[model samples]
Target: MRNVTDRIFQGAISVFIRKGLQATTQEVAKEAGVAEVTLYRRYSTKENLFITVIKNVLEKKFDSHVLEIAKENETEVFLMNIIEDRLEILSKNYDLVKMLLSESLRGNLANEINLPDIIFSSLKKGLEYHFELKNQTVDIDFCARQLGGIFLSYVVLPNAQPFNKLTLQEKKDIARKHAKAVLATI
Candidate 1:
Protein backbone atom coordinates (compact mmCIF):
# COMPACT_ATOMS: atom_id res chain seq x y z
CA MET A 1 0.00 0.00 0.00
CA ARG A 2 2.80 2.41 0.94
CA ASN A 3 4.76 1.59 -2.20
CA VAL A 4 1.74 2.17 -4.37
CA THR A 5 0.96 5.34 -2.52
CA ASP A 6 4.54 6.53 -2.86
CA ARG A 7 4.58 5.74 -6.57
CA ILE A 8 1.34 7.60 -7.05
CA PHE A 9 2.63 10.53 -5.06
CA GLN A 10 5.92 10.65 -6.94
CA GLY A 11 3.95 10.69 -10.14
CA ALA A 12 1.79 13.40 -8.62
CA ILE A 13 4.88 15.51 -7.93
CA SER A 14 5.84 15.29 -11.56
CA VAL A 15 2.36 16.15 -12.73
CA PHE A 16 1.77 18.84 -10.16
CA ILE A 17 5.14 20.35 -10.85
CA ARG A 18 4.40 20.35 -14.53
CA LYS A 19 0.80 21.51 -14.48
CA GLY A 20 0.34 23.24 -11.12
CA LEU A 21 -2.04 22.11 -8.32
CA GLN A 22 -4.83 23.88 -10.14
CA ALA A 23 -4.31 20.85 -12.30
CA THR A 24 -7.05 18.34 -11.66
CA THR A 25 -6.81 15.05 -9.85
CA GLN A 26 -8.00 13.35 -13.02
CA GLU A 27 -4.98 14.67 -14.87
CA VAL A 28 -2.68 13.55 -12.08
CA ALA A 29 -4.37 10.17 -11.88
CA LYS A 30 -4.01 9.89 -15.63
CA GLU A 31 -0.33 10.69 -15.34
CA ALA A 32 -0.04 8.18 -12.56
CA GLY A 33 -2.12 5.69 -14.61
CA VAL A 34 -4.15 5.12 -11.51
CA ALA A 35 -7.85 5.65 -11.20
CA GLU A 36 -8.95 9.00 -9.79
CA VAL A 37 -10.72 6.98 -7.15
CA THR A 38 -7.42 5.40 -6.28
CA LEU A 39 -5.83 8.74 -5.58
CA TYR A 40 -8.78 9.86 -3.50
CA ARG A 41 -8.81 6.49 -1.80
CA ARG A 42 -5.19 6.93 -0.74
CA TYR A 43 -4.98 10.68 -0.19
CA SER A 44 -8.50 11.63 0.92
CA THR A 45 -8.17 15.20 -0.43
CA LYS A 46 -6.17 17.23 -2.91
CA GLU A 47 -4.32 19.17 -0.24
CA ASN A 48 -3.46 16.01 1.64
CA LEU A 49 -2.38 14.30 -1.53
CA PHE A 50 -0.18 17.22 -2.52
CA ILE A 51 1.41 17.26 0.90
CA THR A 52 2.08 13.55 0.73
CA VAL A 53 3.71 13.94 -2.65
CA ILE A 54 5.87 16.84 -1.52
CA LYS A 55 6.98 15.16 1.69
CA ASN A 56 7.87 11.90 -0.01
CA VAL A 57 9.94 13.53 -2.74
CA LEU A 58 11.53 15.73 -0.13
CA GLU A 59 12.64 12.71 1.83
CA LYS A 60 13.58 10.37 -0.99
CA LYS A 61 15.31 12.68 -3.44
CA PHE A 62 16.28 15.90 -1.71
CA ASP A 63 17.07 14.84 1.84
CA SER A 64 18.44 11.33 1.59
CA HIS A 65 20.93 11.91 -1.22
CA VAL A 66 22.31 15.05 0.40
CA LEU A 67 22.84 13.13 3.63
CA GLU A 68 24.51 10.24 1.84
CA ILE A 69 26.82 12.48 -0.11
CA ALA A 70 27.76 14.54 2.95
CA LYS A 71 29.35 11.38 4.33
CA GLU A 72 31.81 11.14 1.49
CA ASN A 73 35.53 11.48 2.30
CA GLU A 74 36.26 13.94 -0.46
CA THR A 75 34.01 16.81 0.53
CA GLU A 76 35.19 18.88 -2.42
CA VAL A 77 34.23 16.20 -4.90
CA PHE A 78 31.04 15.51 -3.00
CA LEU A 79 30.12 19.17 -2.98
CA MET A 80 30.88 19.50 -6.68
CA ASN A 81 28.52 16.65 -7.44
CA ILE A 82 25.84 18.27 -5.34
CA ILE A 83 26.33 21.46 -7.31
CA GLU A 84 26.72 19.85 -10.74
CA ASP A 85 25.30 16.33 -10.71
CA ARG A 86 22.12 17.50 -9.08
CA LEU A 87 21.69 20.00 -11.89
CA GLU A 88 21.63 17.04 -14.29
CA ILE A 89 18.93 15.54 -12.13
CA LEU A 90 17.04 18.80 -12.50
CA SER A 91 17.33 18.71 -16.31
CA LYS A 92 15.47 15.41 -16.29
CA ASN A 93 12.73 17.02 -14.19
CA TYR A 94 12.79 20.56 -15.48
CA ASP A 95 9.12 20.94 -16.23
CA LEU A 96 8.12 19.91 -12.75
CA VAL A 97 10.58 22.33 -11.19
CA LYS A 98 9.26 25.08 -13.39
CA MET A 99 5.72 24.52 -12.16
CA LEU A 100 6.68 24.38 -8.49
CA LEU A 101 8.46 27.72 -8.58
CA SER A 102 5.72 29.44 -10.50
CA GLU A 103 3.01 28.08 -8.23
CA SER A 104 4.85 29.28 -5.13
CA LEU A 105 4.85 32.87 -6.33
CA ARG A 106 1.18 32.77 -7.27
CA GLY A 107 -0.31 32.49 -3.75
CA ASN A 108 -0.38 28.72 -3.43
CA LEU A 109 1.14 28.63 0.01
CA ALA A 110 -0.73 25.52 1.06
CA ASN A 111 0.97 23.79 -1.82
CA GLU A 112 4.38 24.79 -0.51
CA ILE A 113 6.84 22.70 1.49
CA ASN A 114 9.43 23.54 4.13
CA LEU A 115 12.46 25.36 2.75
CA PRO A 116 14.71 26.19 5.69
CA ASP A 117 14.49 22.76 7.24
CA ILE A 118 15.39 21.14 3.97
CA ILE A 119 18.26 23.52 3.41
CA PHE A 120 19.47 23.14 6.98
CA SER A 121 19.23 19.36 6.79
CA SER A 122 21.35 19.17 3.65
CA LEU A 123 23.89 21.57 5.13
CA LYS A 124 24.14 19.56 8.33
CA LYS A 125 24.71 16.37 6.37
CA GLY A 126 27.34 18.03 4.19
CA LEU A 127 29.13 19.37 7.22
CA GLU A 128 29.09 16.03 8.99
CA TYR A 129 30.68 14.42 5.96
CA HIS A 130 33.21 17.12 5.30
CA PHE A 131 34.45 18.12 8.72
CA GLU A 132 34.85 15.04 10.87
CA LEU A 133 38.35 15.78 11.96
CA LYS A 134 38.87 16.69 15.60
CA ASN A 135 40.81 19.87 14.97
CA GLN A 136 38.42 21.32 12.39
CA THR A 137 35.23 23.21 13.15
CA VAL A 138 32.67 24.68 10.83
CA ASP A 139 29.09 25.93 10.86
CA ILE A 140 27.86 23.31 8.44
CA ASP A 141 24.20 24.27 8.20
CA PHE A 142 24.85 27.95 7.49
CA CYS A 143 27.39 27.27 4.81
CA ALA A 144 25.22 24.55 3.30
CA ARG A 145 22.25 26.86 2.97
CA GLN A 146 24.40 29.69 1.68
CA LEU A 147 25.97 27.59 -1.01
CA GLY A 148 22.91 25.41 -1.43
CA GLY A 149 20.78 28.49 -2.01
CA ILE A 150 23.11 29.45 -4.82
CA PHE A 151 22.76 26.03 -6.39
CA LEU A 152 19.01 26.09 -5.86
CA SER A 153 18.81 29.43 -7.66
CA TYR A 154 20.69 27.92 -10.55
CA VAL A 155 18.32 24.96 -10.62
CA VAL A 156 15.16 27.08 -10.91
CA LEU A 157 16.61 29.41 -13.48
CA PRO A 158 14.52 29.91 -16.67
CA ASN A 159 16.19 26.81 -18.20
CA ALA A 160 16.19 28.89 -21.35
CA GLN A 161 19.89 29.18 -20.69
CA PRO A 162 22.11 26.19 -20.25
CA PHE A 163 23.87 26.04 -16.86
CA ASN A 164 26.66 28.20 -18.26
CA LYS A 165 24.95 29.12 -21.51
CA LEU A 166 27.49 26.88 -23.18
CA THR A 167 28.42 23.22 -23.63
CA LEU A 168 28.27 20.54 -20.93
CA GLN A 169 31.99 20.84 -20.36
CA GLU A 170 31.62 24.56 -19.69
CA LYS A 171 28.90 24.00 -17.13
CA LYS A 172 31.01 21.42 -15.34
CA ASP A 173 33.95 23.78 -15.35
CA ILE A 174 31.84 26.56 -13.89
CA ALA A 175 30.34 24.21 -11.33
CA ARG A 176 33.81 23.07 -10.33
CA LYS A 177 34.76 26.67 -9.67
CA HIS A 178 31.48 27.33 -7.87
CA ALA A 179 32.03 24.27 -5.72
CA LYS A 180 35.46 25.60 -4.78
CA ALA A 181 33.96 28.93 -3.78
CA VAL A 182 31.35 27.11 -1.70
CA LEU A 183 34.13 25.17 0.04
CA ALA A 184 36.18 28.29 0.68
CA THR A 185 33.78 29.19 3.48
CA ILE A 186 34.64 25.94 5.21
Candidate 2:
Protein backbone atom coordinates (compact mmCIF):
# COMPACT_ATOMS: atom_id res chain seq x y z
CA MET A 1 0.00 0.00 0.00
CA ARG A 2 2.77 2.39 0.91
CA ASN A 3 4.71 1.46 -2.21
CA VAL A 4 1.67 2.10 -4.37
CA THR A 5 1.26 5.52 -2.78
CA ASP A 6 4.97 6.23 -3.24
CA ARG A 7 4.88 5.19 -6.89
CA ILE A 8 1.91 7.44 -7.49
CA PHE A 9 3.81 10.22 -5.73
CA GLN A 10 7.00 9.59 -7.63
CA GLY A 11 5.03 9.90 -10.84
CA ALA A 12 3.51 13.08 -9.54
CA ILE A 13 6.97 14.43 -8.75
CA SER A 14 8.03 13.85 -12.35
CA VAL A 15 4.86 15.53 -13.51
CA PHE A 16 5.46 18.50 -11.22
CA ILE A 17 9.01 18.93 -12.46
CA ARG A 18 7.95 18.52 -16.08
CA LYS A 19 4.82 20.61 -15.70
CA GLY A 20 4.00 22.45 -12.47
CA LEU A 21 2.09 21.99 -9.23
CA GLN A 22 -0.99 23.43 -10.95
CA ALA A 23 -1.18 20.57 -13.42
CA THR A 24 -4.49 18.74 -13.80
CA THR A 25 -5.54 15.52 -12.11
CA GLN A 26 -6.02 13.95 -15.52
CA GLU A 27 -2.42 14.68 -16.33
CA VAL A 28 -1.26 13.34 -12.97
CA ALA A 29 -3.31 10.21 -13.38
CA LYS A 30 -1.82 9.61 -16.79
CA GLU A 31 1.64 10.18 -15.44
CA ALA A 32 1.02 7.74 -12.58
CA GLY A 33 -0.29 5.05 -14.96
CA VAL A 34 -3.59 4.97 -13.14
CA ALA A 35 -7.12 5.75 -14.23
CA GLU A 36 -8.49 9.20 -13.48
CA VAL A 37 -11.18 7.67 -11.30
CA THR A 38 -8.54 5.72 -9.41
CA LEU A 39 -6.54 8.85 -8.75
CA TYR A 40 -9.61 10.74 -7.61
CA ARG A 41 -10.56 7.90 -5.30
CA ARG A 42 -7.09 7.93 -3.80
CA TYR A 43 -6.52 11.65 -3.41
CA SER A 44 -9.98 13.23 -3.73
CA THR A 45 -8.50 16.61 -4.78
CA LYS A 46 -5.54 18.04 -6.64
CA GLU A 47 -4.46 20.17 -3.67
CA ASN A 48 -4.38 17.12 -1.43
CA LEU A 49 -2.38 15.29 -4.02
CA PHE A 50 0.04 18.17 -4.52
CA ILE A 51 0.61 18.66 -0.80
CA THR A 52 1.12 14.96 -0.37
CA VAL A 53 3.64 15.07 -3.19
CA ILE A 54 5.52 17.95 -1.60
CA LYS A 55 5.46 16.32 1.83
CA ASN A 56 6.77 13.08 0.44
CA VAL A 57 9.56 14.82 -1.47
CA LEU A 58 10.55 16.76 1.62
CA GLU A 59 10.65 13.67 3.84
CA LYS A 60 12.57 11.64 1.32
CA LYS A 61 15.08 14.37 0.65
CA PHE A 62 15.60 14.95 4.33
CA ASP A 63 16.24 11.28 4.89
CA SER A 64 18.28 10.57 1.78
CA HIS A 65 19.18 13.65 -0.21
CA VAL A 66 20.67 15.73 2.61
CA LEU A 67 23.95 13.96 2.95
CA GLU A 68 25.85 13.86 6.24
CA ILE A 69 28.43 16.60 5.66
CA ALA A 70 31.28 16.32 8.12
CA LYS A 71 34.89 17.42 7.98
CA GLU A 72 38.17 16.73 9.80
CA ASN A 73 39.33 20.27 9.20
CA GLU A 74 39.32 22.53 12.26
CA THR A 75 38.32 26.20 12.26
CA GLU A 76 38.17 27.63 8.71
CA VAL A 77 39.05 24.29 7.17
CA PHE A 78 35.45 23.23 7.79
CA LEU A 79 34.44 25.83 5.17
CA MET A 80 35.45 23.80 2.13
CA ASN A 81 33.25 20.91 3.21
CA ILE A 82 30.23 23.15 2.83
CA ILE A 83 31.31 24.35 -0.59
CA GLU A 84 32.34 20.97 -1.97
CA ASP A 85 29.19 19.17 -0.87
CA ARG A 86 26.84 21.90 -2.13
CA LEU A 87 28.67 22.24 -5.43
CA GLU A 88 28.48 18.49 -5.93
CA ILE A 89 24.73 18.52 -5.44
CA LEU A 90 24.29 21.65 -7.57
CA SER A 91 26.33 20.18 -10.39
CA LYS A 92 24.34 16.94 -10.53
CA ASN A 93 20.76 18.09 -9.88
CA TYR A 94 21.15 21.46 -11.53
CA ASP A 95 17.62 21.52 -12.97
CA LEU A 96 15.92 20.70 -9.70
CA VAL A 97 18.02 23.42 -8.09
CA LYS A 98 17.10 25.79 -10.88
CA MET A 99 13.44 25.04 -10.20
CA LEU A 100 13.85 25.61 -6.46
CA LEU A 101 15.68 28.91 -7.00
CA SER A 102 13.20 30.17 -9.62
CA GLU A 103 10.15 29.28 -7.57
CA SER A 104 11.74 30.83 -4.50
CA LEU A 105 12.19 34.09 -6.44
CA ARG A 106 8.51 33.98 -7.40
CA GLY A 107 7.57 33.37 -3.74
CA ASN A 108 6.63 29.75 -4.30
CA LEU A 109 8.54 27.68 -1.69
CA ALA A 110 8.14 28.21 2.05
CA ASN A 111 10.34 30.75 3.86
CA GLU A 112 12.90 27.93 4.04
CA ILE A 113 12.12 24.71 5.87
CA ASN A 114 13.40 25.04 9.42
CA LEU A 115 14.44 21.59 10.56
CA PRO A 116 17.29 19.31 9.54
CA ASP A 117 19.63 22.30 9.49
CA ILE A 118 22.80 20.53 8.49
CA ILE A 119 24.84 23.71 8.44
CA PHE A 120 24.31 24.34 12.12
CA SER A 121 24.85 20.69 12.82
CA SER A 122 28.20 20.87 11.02
CA LEU A 123 29.26 24.00 12.87
CA LYS A 124 28.32 22.84 16.35
CA LYS A 125 29.77 19.41 15.81
CA GLY A 126 32.95 20.76 14.25
CA LEU A 127 33.42 23.28 17.04
CA GLU A 128 32.79 20.76 19.80
CA TYR A 129 35.06 18.22 18.18
CA HIS A 130 37.76 20.83 18.02
CA PHE A 131 37.32 21.44 21.79
CA GLU A 132 35.84 24.91 21.34
CA LEU A 133 32.68 26.24 22.98
CA LYS A 134 30.54 29.40 23.49
CA ASN A 135 29.12 29.22 19.96
CA GLN A 136 25.67 30.83 19.90
CA THR A 137 22.56 29.06 18.79
CA VAL A 138 22.89 30.20 15.21
CA ASP A 139 20.05 31.68 13.22
CA ILE A 140 19.55 28.69 10.96
CA ASP A 141 16.82 30.49 9.02
CA PHE A 142 19.03 33.40 8.06
CA CYS A 143 21.77 31.05 6.94
CA ALA A 144 19.24 29.29 4.74
CA ARG A 145 18.33 32.60 3.18
CA GLN A 146 21.96 33.43 2.60
CA LEU A 147 22.67 30.16 0.84
CA GLY A 148 19.43 30.28 -1.13
CA GLY A 149 20.02 33.85 -2.19
CA ILE A 150 23.52 33.01 -3.36
CA PHE A 151 22.33 30.14 -5.52
CA LEU A 152 19.37 32.13 -6.81
CA SER A 153 21.58 35.02 -7.89
CA TYR A 154 24.14 32.71 -9.40
CA VAL A 155 21.58 30.78 -11.41
CA VAL A 156 19.88 33.90 -12.72
CA LEU A 157 23.04 35.85 -13.41
CA PRO A 158 23.21 37.58 -16.78
CA ASN A 159 25.57 36.04 -19.31
CA ALA A 160 27.80 39.11 -19.39
CA GLN A 161 29.04 39.09 -15.79
CA PRO A 162 32.49 37.53 -15.51
CA PHE A 163 31.70 36.18 -12.06
CA ASN A 164 28.57 34.66 -13.55
CA LYS A 165 30.77 32.65 -15.89
CA LEU A 166 33.26 31.73 -13.17
CA THR A 167 35.21 28.51 -13.50
CA LEU A 168 34.89 25.66 -10.99
CA GLN A 169 37.78 26.98 -8.91
CA GLU A 170 36.27 30.47 -8.95
CA LYS A 171 32.89 29.03 -8.07
CA LYS A 172 34.41 27.12 -5.17
CA ASP A 173 36.26 30.21 -4.01
CA ILE A 174 33.14 32.35 -4.13
CA ALA A 175 31.00 29.70 -2.42
CA ARG A 176 33.57 29.16 0.32
CA LYS A 177 33.93 32.89 0.82
CA HIS A 178 30.18 33.23 1.25
CA ALA A 179 30.02 30.28 3.60
CA LYS A 180 32.83 31.73 5.72
CA ALA A 181 31.08 35.09 5.82
CA VAL A 182 27.92 33.47 7.14
CA LEU A 183 29.84 31.19 9.50
CA ALA A 184 31.37 34.20 11.20
CA THR A 185 27.91 35.47 12.02
CA ILE A 186 26.70 32.12 13.33
Candidate 3:
Protein backbone atom coordinates (compact mmCIF):
# COMPACT_ATOMS: atom_id res chain seq x y z
CA MET A 1 0.00 0.00 0.00
CA ARG A 2 2.79 2.41 0.86
CA ASN A 3 4.65 1.43 -2.29
CA VAL A 4 1.63 2.17 -4.45
CA THR A 5 1.12 5.53 -2.79
CA ASP A 6 4.76 6.45 -3.29
CA ARG A 7 4.58 5.54 -6.95
CA ILE A 8 1.45 7.58 -7.36
CA PHE A 9 2.94 10.58 -5.60
CA GLN A 10 6.08 10.37 -7.74
CA GLY A 11 4.03 10.08 -10.89
CA ALA A 12 1.77 12.95 -9.86
CA ILE A 13 4.78 15.15 -9.23
CA SER A 14 6.27 14.39 -12.63
CA VAL A 15 3.07 14.89 -14.57
CA PHE A 16 2.00 17.96 -12.60
CA ILE A 17 5.35 19.62 -13.15
CA ARG A 18 5.15 18.81 -16.83
CA LYS A 19 1.52 19.74 -17.40
CA GLY A 20 0.59 21.93 -14.42
CA LEU A 21 -3.05 21.92 -13.33
CA GLN A 22 -4.12 20.71 -16.75
CA ALA A 23 -2.65 17.29 -16.09
CA THR A 24 -5.26 14.54 -15.99
CA THR A 25 -5.59 11.62 -13.65
CA GLN A 26 -5.19 9.17 -16.53
CA GLU A 27 -1.74 10.49 -17.31
CA VAL A 28 -0.80 10.35 -13.64
CA ALA A 29 -2.10 6.79 -13.35
CA LYS A 30 -0.19 5.73 -16.48
CA GLU A 31 2.97 7.34 -15.17
CA ALA A 32 2.49 5.52 -11.89
CA GLY A 33 1.81 2.22 -13.69
CA VAL A 34 -1.53 2.03 -11.93
CA ALA A 35 -5.05 1.84 -13.25
CA GLU A 36 -6.99 5.06 -13.74
CA VAL A 37 -9.70 3.68 -11.54
CA THR A 38 -7.19 3.14 -8.80
CA LEU A 39 -6.17 6.80 -8.81
CA TYR A 40 -9.75 7.97 -8.93
CA ARG A 41 -10.71 5.65 -6.16
CA ARG A 42 -7.93 6.94 -3.99
CA TYR A 43 -7.94 10.64 -4.84
CA SER A 44 -11.52 11.28 -6.03
CA THR A 45 -10.32 14.08 -8.35
CA LYS A 46 -7.24 15.46 -10.00
CA GLU A 47 -7.30 18.56 -7.79
CA ASN A 48 -7.41 16.42 -4.66
CA LEU A 49 -4.46 14.39 -5.85
CA PHE A 50 -2.54 17.51 -6.85
CA ILE A 51 -3.06 19.10 -3.45
CA THR A 52 -2.15 15.91 -1.64
CA VAL A 53 0.97 15.38 -3.69
CA ILE A 54 2.10 18.98 -3.23
CA LYS A 55 1.47 18.97 0.53
CA ASN A 56 3.31 15.66 0.80
CA VAL A 57 6.25 17.03 -1.16
CA LEU A 58 6.48 20.22 0.92
CA GLU A 59 6.14 18.39 4.23
CA LYS A 60 8.66 15.76 3.25
CA LYS A 61 11.14 18.07 1.60
CA PHE A 62 11.00 21.39 3.43
CA ASP A 63 9.03 21.91 6.63
CA SER A 64 10.26 19.23 9.01
CA HIS A 65 13.95 19.89 8.38
CA VAL A 66 13.54 23.64 8.80
CA LEU A 67 11.85 23.22 12.16
CA GLU A 68 14.48 20.74 13.29
CA ILE A 69 17.29 23.07 12.27
CA ALA A 70 15.60 25.97 14.04
CA LYS A 71 15.44 23.99 17.27
CA GLU A 72 19.08 22.90 17.13
CA ASN A 73 21.02 26.00 16.07
CA GLU A 74 21.81 29.61 16.87
CA THR A 75 20.32 32.41 14.80
CA GLU A 76 23.13 32.86 12.28
CA VAL A 77 23.85 29.18 12.00
CA PHE A 78 20.18 28.43 11.59
CA LEU A 79 19.86 31.00 8.84
CA MET A 80 22.85 29.67 6.97
CA ASN A 81 21.79 26.07 7.32
CA ILE A 82 18.25 26.77 6.18
CA ILE A 83 19.42 28.85 3.26
CA GLU A 84 21.94 26.28 2.05
CA ASP A 85 19.58 23.36 2.47
CA ARG A 86 16.69 25.13 0.74
CA LEU A 87 18.91 26.32 -2.10
CA GLU A 88 20.06 22.80 -2.82
CA ILE A 89 16.56 21.37 -2.65
CA LEU A 90 14.99 24.13 -4.72
CA SER A 91 17.70 23.97 -7.34
CA LYS A 92 17.29 20.23 -7.75
CA ASN A 93 13.53 20.63 -7.95
CA TYR A 94 13.70 23.67 -10.21
CA ASP A 95 11.21 22.38 -12.73
CA LEU A 96 8.62 21.60 -10.11
CA VAL A 97 9.18 24.96 -8.45
CA LYS A 98 8.88 26.79 -11.72
CA MET A 99 5.73 24.95 -12.63
CA LEU A 100 4.14 25.64 -9.28
CA LEU A 101 5.16 29.29 -9.35
CA SER A 102 3.86 29.75 -12.83
CA GLU A 103 0.58 28.10 -11.98
CA SER A 104 0.36 30.21 -8.83
CA LEU A 105 0.99 33.42 -10.73
CA ARG A 106 -1.78 32.52 -13.12
CA GLY A 107 -4.17 32.04 -10.16
CA ASN A 108 -4.64 28.38 -10.89
CA LEU A 109 -3.79 26.99 -7.48
CA ALA A 110 -5.97 27.13 -4.38
CA ASN A 111 -5.24 29.46 -1.47
CA GLU A 112 -4.19 26.64 0.85
CA ILE A 113 -1.74 25.34 -1.74
CA ASN A 114 -0.18 28.70 -2.48
CA LEU A 115 3.49 27.78 -2.60
CA PRO A 116 4.98 31.14 -1.69
CA ASP A 117 2.67 31.61 1.25
CA ILE A 118 3.37 28.12 2.46
CA ILE A 119 7.15 28.57 2.24
CA PHE A 120 7.17 31.93 3.98
CA SER A 121 4.76 30.73 6.64
CA SER A 122 6.93 27.74 7.39
CA LEU A 123 9.95 30.00 7.74
CA LYS A 124 8.04 32.38 9.97
CA LYS A 125 6.93 29.55 12.21
CA GLY A 126 10.46 28.28 12.53
CA LEU A 127 11.85 31.72 13.28
CA GLU A 128 9.13 32.43 15.80
CA TYR A 129 9.74 29.21 17.62
CA HIS A 130 13.48 29.71 17.70
CA PHE A 131 13.22 33.30 18.92
CA GLU A 132 10.71 32.40 21.57
CA LEU A 133 12.88 29.64 22.92
CA LYS A 134 15.84 32.01 23.22
CA ASN A 135 13.80 34.94 24.60
CA GLN A 136 15.01 37.05 21.70
CA THR A 137 12.69 39.60 20.23
CA VAL A 138 12.97 40.39 16.54
CA ASP A 139 10.66 41.25 13.70
CA ILE A 140 9.98 37.65 12.82
CA ASP A 141 7.62 38.47 9.96
CA PHE A 142 10.23 40.63 8.29
CA CYS A 143 12.91 38.04 8.83
CA ALA A 144 10.77 35.33 7.39
CA ARG A 145 9.98 37.44 4.36
CA GLN A 146 13.64 38.23 3.88
CA LEU A 147 14.59 34.60 4.02
CA GLY A 148 11.80 33.68 1.65
CA GLY A 149 12.90 36.39 -0.75
CA ILE A 150 16.44 35.08 -0.68
CA PHE A 151 15.28 31.58 -1.48
CA LEU A 152 12.94 32.73 -4.26
CA SER A 153 15.57 34.96 -5.82
CA TYR A 154 17.89 31.99 -6.17
CA VAL A 155 15.14 29.98 -7.79
CA VAL A 156 13.78 32.69 -10.11
CA LEU A 157 16.84 34.74 -11.00
CA PRO A 158 19.26 33.72 -13.69
CA ASN A 159 22.57 32.30 -12.56
CA ALA A 160 25.69 31.06 -14.31
CA GLN A 161 25.36 27.79 -12.45
CA PRO A 162 22.41 26.41 -10.53
CA PHE A 163 22.74 25.96 -6.75
CA ASN A 164 22.90 22.19 -7.07
CA LYS A 165 25.75 22.48 -9.59
CA LEU A 166 27.89 24.67 -7.34
CA THR A 167 30.78 23.19 -5.40
CA LEU A 168 30.29 22.62 -1.67
CA GLN A 169 32.50 25.57 -0.78
CA GLU A 170 30.63 27.78 -3.20
CA LYS A 171 27.31 26.76 -1.72
CA LYS A 172 28.49 27.39 1.81
CA ASP A 173 29.91 30.75 0.79
CA ILE A 174 26.64 31.76 -0.78
CA ALA A 175 24.70 30.71 2.29
CA ARG A 176 27.14 32.46 4.61
CA LYS A 177 26.98 35.65 2.60
CA HIS A 178 23.18 35.72 2.56
CA ALA A 179 22.92 34.82 6.21
CA LYS A 180 25.25 37.68 7.17
CA ALA A 181 23.33 40.17 5.08
CA VAL A 182 20.08 39.10 6.72
CA LEU A 183 21.60 39.35 10.18
CA ALA A 184 23.13 42.71 9.46
CA THR A 185 19.78 44.10 8.41
CA ILE A 186 17.86 42.77 11.43
Candidate with top lDDT is 3
Please say which candidate is ahead in TM-score: 2 or 3: 3
Q: After superposition, which runs of candidate 2 have C-alpha atoms over 4 Å from their true positions?
A: 1-3, 62-67, 70-77, 97-144, 158-175, 183-186
Clashing pairs in 3: none
Could you report the Cα RMSD, in angstroms, for every candidate shown?
Answer: 3.6, 5.7, 1.6
lDDT of 2: 0.56
Give the alpha-carbon lDDT of every model.
Answer: 0.68, 0.56, 0.88
Candidate 3 residues lying further than 4 Å off, grouped into runs, are none
Per-candidate TM-score against the hidden true structure: 0.76, 0.59, 0.94
Q: Write the per-residue lDDT of candidate 1 for residues 1-186, one digit (tens) a residue.
A: 456665687678777877777878888888777899998888888878887777666556556566566656676777776776556555555565566667667867462465436545765766666677333577876676767676577765555675634587876786788778877877
Task: State the lDDT of candidate 2 residue by residue for 39-99, as single tens digits.
Answer: 7788898767766666565545433423334324443445455554544444454455455
Q: 1-186 in candidate 3: lDDT tens per residue?
A: 459999999999999999999999989999998999999899899999999999889766777667788885578888888898888989998999999999988998877687877787778888888888788899998898888889989988999999999999999999999999999988
Off by over 4 Å in 1: 1-7, 133-135, 158-171
Query: How should the candidates be ordered by lDDT, best one leading?
Result: 3, 1, 2
Provide the lDDT at 56 for model 1: 64
Better model by TM-score: candidate 1 vs candidate 2: 1
